[model samples]
Each structure stands twice: as C-alpha cells, then as structure tokens.
Target: MLQLQVPCSWYFWALAFGFNLAMHNLKNILISVVIVSNLGKIIRTCTCLYKQDSTEHHDHIE
Candidate 1:
C-alpha cells in the first residue's frame, strides 16, 4: 500500500524547494559578514589616522 502512494514529482519538488532555500540563506549570510568586516576595518583605520594626525599637529606647535 505505501509503495504506490507517493508521487514521483513530489520528491523532485521538495528537493528543489529545499535547495533553493539553503542557497538563499547561505548567500545572505556571506554578504552580511563581508559587509560587516569591511566596514569595521574602515572605521578602525579612520580612527587611527585621526589620532596620529592630531598628535603630530600638537607636537609641531610646541
């Protein structure tokens, strides 16, 4: 009774849906990490440069 109950297209559809969902989730996660990491690096570098410039400016005035 169970052998004939399942349809052939049902498995294909289920697999395709699951694959699509997995790919979408993976893509979103990759993009988020890349953006966050790059932004953090940029902010840190800017802060370092600002501090160095201010220190140099104060030394030149003395």
Candidate 2:
C-alpha cells in the first residue's frame, strides 16, 4: 500500500507542477502581446499626427 501510494502522490504533484508552469508561461505571452500591440498603436498614432502637422504646415506656406 505504501509503495502504491507514493507513486500516485508523485504523479499528482508532477501534474500540478506542469500545470503551474504552463499557466505562468501563458501569462507572460499574453502580457508581451498586449505590450507589442499597444506599442504599434502608439506608433501609428504618432505617424498620423506628424503627417497631419506637415500637411498643415505646407498649406500655410503656400
């Protein structure tokens, strides 16, 4: 009985450990994706603003 129980407990612990590791990795991936998408949005917004400013400036000069 002792021998059978030890192996079963070990298997359970291993499964738990793997699950925790996977969740941690998934969280990191989600965070990175959000950060990257936000950065892209910010870059696009800046580019649009810059283009608008340049066009307005040229109009004033003309």
RMSD of each: 6.7, 7.0
Instruction: For model 2, state the Cα shift of residue 3 in Å.
Output: 32
Give the top-scoring candidate (TM-score): 2
Error of 1 at 23 (Å): 3.8
Leading candidate by lDDT = 2
- Candidate 1, residue 29: the lDDT equals 81
- Candidate 1 stretches with Cα past 4 Å from truth are 1-22
Q: Please provide, for model 2 over 1-62, each residue's C-alpha lDDT reduced to its tens digit, 9 standing for 90 to 100.
A: 99999999999999999898879799888999999999999999999999999999999999
Write model 1 residue lDDT over 1-62, tens digit each, in one string.
56555765678788999898878799888999999999999999999999999999999998
TM-score, cand. 1 vs. native: 0.57
